[model samples]
Target chain A: MGSAMGVLLDIAGVLYEGDRPIPGAVDAVRRLRGSGLAVRYLTNSTRRPKRRIVERLRSLGFPVDPAEILTPAEAACDWLRREGYAPHLLIHPDLEEDFMDLPKSDRIAVVVGDAGPCFSYERMNAAFRELERGAPFLALAINRVFKDRDGKLSLDAGAFVKALEYSSGTPALLLGKPSRDFFVAGARSMGCALGDVTMIGDDAESDVSGAIAAGVRAAIHVQTGKYRAGDETQHDHRPSALARDIAAAVDLLVETD
Target chain B: MGSAMGVLLDIAGVLYEGDRPIPGAVDAVRRLRGSGLAVRYLTNSTRRPKRRIVERLRSLGFPVDPAEILTPAEAACDWLRREGYAPHLLIHPDLEEDFMDLPKSDRIAVVVGDAGPCFSYERMNAAFRELERGAPFLALAINRVFKDRDGKLSLDAGAFVKALEYSSGTPALLLGKPSRDFFVAGARSMGCALGDVTMIGDDAESDVSGAIAAGVRAAIHVQTGKYRAGDETQHDHRPSALARDIAAAVDLLVETD
Candidate 1:
């Protein structure tokens, strides 16, 4: 086949939920390796940096690398730079490394990054107060909900973003998946056409559906991360293949690259 | 006309932004007296305590009693009681005032509140570790974003909750909008049928659309807080009446009431 056969993977539900590996996740990656194809992992996960995502995968016995991973946060930083900040005041934990030692300001604000539950009323009051002064709301990833390894669903940055949009009546600029920009960026960086790629993961809406819309020929949805057996209806568009585990996804894909 | 014809008001966007009153908000409320109808300030604001909301409105020159206000937080608390909470962690400024007085949790982990741009990385790390244990991602009000009178937007506690959800892959229980329990509580407290009441608000989706979905027919949209000219198309369901400002909203509804 063409370079279009390159594989893209999602780790959370695909490889492992936590320390425990998914049923077929490990063999899936090993099998993809047996076919001798390039693999990439992409996730909308906004938690730990790429290093942790990789480390966690290795701990779970899945063949993964930090370089192979692309998170919405990384895309968020890139997206922010493409549209230069007005010295935006950030509301995130430890953004210093990401902001590259830029000075902080209370004057200008752009709502970016993860909204940890550690968020305070004082924080809410401060932001609300700032919004009252007319600052723009720029959210990193507007995902309303996210699921953890144990397969429990919870609110994500998007839910809070929606809340603010409703409360303040301010429009937000979303920079992550389903937005189309990140999808395009990943493709450009890969230096490949859309045909050569397969987005494999648990989330059908963001990863698979977004990849499909971005022109990927195939998207393999693994029931590994937040996706459970009964959540088929949650996806607006169906995946090219459905595998019980990650290894099954690799087997499902026709090796080309 | 019945009492249903009277003015059903919305608090946040129409009357104020942040802790300060909107420029013409108090004046508009005073003028509502001429309409010869009772002004009931209905709010979907879930963040603040009821007494605080009432106090804030009273300080802004509008006469408001505790009964005149309806918040999703109260409704959520009620729901929590009905459903049950096992000693959960809290991340708000004033826990005793918000949750401790209500029903208590057994296995609480983190208790956070507003401390500003100073959200430490250490704090976030600790929260993640506890939540990794899979305690419920609990919150009081899920509204994180806010607009000041000048319209500057910023993230609040809801955003923090969102961040945690993304990191740990857990969902939160919103004590506010989209929760039918809250609306039912509001109607119950008001001792009115959910359909007979009218909700006047400026937010296109959250307030107006929420009210309509809750069976309120008359919703007034104003360009005061989150309302702008371009907001007309954000939601398919528009308000029953459109007002340029709260003054206009009162002017139109006063006669009918």
Candidate 2:
């Protein structure tokens, strides 16, 4: 790719699967960075902190830095800090460690995600009560399912987020993939305009359509990890290009350049 | 009402609000019974067993019998028993006592309701896994909201049921108030044909339209409990009559008779 072309990469299904890295993904990242392309990792994963995700990538032999990783937790934490809001987080227990740096106060804002074992009726109702009392609702992502460690598709955070929305009649502010702000913020972190960046990932809706909607220069769909057959055809948004995998996507980018 | 005119009454909004009975509701039931009308209490309440519900109504000074009280749980339990399906109950902890009489086996069927404090990601995912494995999804009721003890509208079982449906790509068989089968079952239990029965309730969609669709002779919408000001006008199925409350509903039925 050209030196000025920035790229946003998805993590869970693109570069790695659970603790294992996708084949040729680590080399593809190296090749993209070697080509002087500005690259940032954008993810909707709410189960782990950004530091943990970075550490995981490094352990999997991928060259990922803390600054180069973008997650909804970070975006939510930033939004919370910037707005001076005290959030009542209903996220995964492992993800709670990331929001400890925010200011603590009596003000309550309801934040929801795939809380895993941490999700309970008490906590959900607590969040619902806050929403009923006019507190703001923030969602990490509405992705329906995620591939678990056992290689099985498990329910994601979207169901619970939607449940709360349906119950309270309050729309949630999505701060993760498919949300234009999350995409634009990632591009901004790379010091590039939205129109100058390209997002490449397996999830057609979250990564591809989300980036395209945010006015990113282009979005590339990779037919690896979590890429369902005919996903590109089913969705309303069209991907700018399609590749066999992350490695092929990198090659396509470079060849097009 | 005439001796042959059977009345199907909705309990939650029409006769009671949480633990407390609506003013004059007990007297209305008594008057309807005194007039020699066949009365059946059709409810969508899944938080408690039918026995407990009947006891609660009795405690609240309503002349309700075990056979006179019909709930979605009872309908669902009956359906399960008839189909010889072993049920994995995802319902309120208190409601578990109701389905204990079902035959035990390795054959897994998912039965869902307002699980209340029992609703967790693990349990929900377990149910989703069962649905994915081709188990039938049975829902007690899909009523969007219910009036709570504090008189505020609270989230009901429908939201979770819908979440599971959306996630697993499975449709739930509703065995509750809005389902025509549930309404017909109540009429059948009363030894009355569907055309000889009248349903009276505050919820327009579940009680009124549901009965009308099931071929009930008439449906009455009451302006009490959770009834919004214009709910009767907003729905496509017009209630045969509109009353101010339970007392007025009984009066309207008798006067028309």
Candidate 3:
């Protein structure tokens, strides 16, 4: 039983996509559930409301509590507020709703993302126009690309953010991934201090380093996610443990400690 | 006024996006009208039908006769056919019509582009299956990023192509941009030989060098468009001629010789 050491789950690739479950993903979740680990479904599904994310996960055979589903949108809104960046931002147009809690202004923050086609000239113009008028550019995650549905890759938000960086010469704040605050927020939202938590995920950049930065006692990296490029010799390396899959992740946690 | 040397206009940043027009860009085409220059919009608009492109350009401001538009799509399809790569496998999902002219089945030469979100496991699976079945990976432009309407840049087709590159360790046969055939296609559209022409455009990598590769007598780098880094030193350190704007471009031609 993993009740003593908690586990966090990543949704998209680890859980399900749209309606179909990834191969063997449910069994992995069930195995974790059977172990009694506190399962938090951490997701960057800013596109969907939290309810949908939870409902979808439940439908896919995962037991997810409403309070347990975490999203970057929430962290983004929180980070914006905490940092005192003016609320009204020309955020990625795709994430207009993410900023619903933030105050709005006619002027916009500088626009950037490898996020999607959302980086269109219209979105860039809106962000650039606001930035041109003295709005600061606060960008989200800057990963070069995101692994797509088919487990292949495409440029992610970072590429677009860098494009604006080259164009505007303004550096935006990063809210998620490798940013300490995201892990801090995750723990804070879980109503626990980072020192008490055991964090595990597939990405070293976001999971391990981020957890470490926020003071998580331990971090486990699963080789299956973004880090399928998982050579520890690469830059940004170092985790308490590494595993090929979720099952391996739980084993690493048990074995390492 | 431009018809004298036989105009060799570059596409990409110069003319259209996908199959659409850049804002206020119709003016360039309108200006080209009756300018007495043998005008041809030479493009690397890979994955598009030139006929459709001509129609799109006319709606945007080009007096482009469909016959006047030179595309990598045509050249690629042509190359595929001649090399007996006919009906070559197309990796890109967007412009299948471009390949329709090719010999059907068993002759599919290669697949191309970054394939976007569709570059999914399924898409890559399909490409790999074909490649496993002996299809080559053919690419059009391998641009790393493209500017959105917002002026922020996002991933280009290169990222997807790269994954396939990683997966197969096979380089793609590029069919557009810096390729020599691209420049030759431009001149061919103008009814001129490469050595007799001058190449003009914004992107130094794809346009200037491509012009040089095609044996263009000269190239002028415009600072306003694609290669505008706000700092010229970072780009191709040497431009045959540098102009800050289009008017400056015209002035450079007048003053140079």
Best by lDDT: 2
lDDT tens digits, residue span A1-257, model 3: 23334566666655554467656677777776666555676654444556667778788877768888766666666655665564544344555655666765443444333335443444544554455456777666655444666566444555445545544446677765556676666666656666766776765656676667667777777666456564444445477777666666666444332
For model 2, which pairs clash? none
**What TM-score would each prediction reach against the true structure?**
0.60, 0.86, 0.58
> DockQ score for model 1, please?
0.15
Give DockQ for candidates 1 onward, in order. Answer: 0.15, 0.55, 0.05
Worst 10 residues of 1 chain B by lDDT: B87-96
Q: Write the per-residue lDDT of candidate 1 for residues B1-257, one digit (tens) a residue.
A: 23463456778878886677767678778867555545566565544567777777888888777876666545545555665653343443332355555556565444333323544444544565567676655454444444544455455455555556655656766555434455555555556666656666776765676667767647677887766686656675778777877877766655533
True contacts kept of each: 0.13, 0.51, 0.00
User: lDDT tens digits, residues A214-249, model 1?
Assistant: 788787777767775755455566777777777667
What do the candidate models score in CA lDDT, each in turn? Answer: 0.61, 0.84, 0.59
Q: What is the lDDT of residue A234 in candidate 1?
A: 56
Candidate 1: what's its TM-score on chain B?
0.75
Question: What level of docking quality does candidate 1 show?
Answer: incorrect
- Candidates 2 and 3 compared: the better one by TM-score is 2
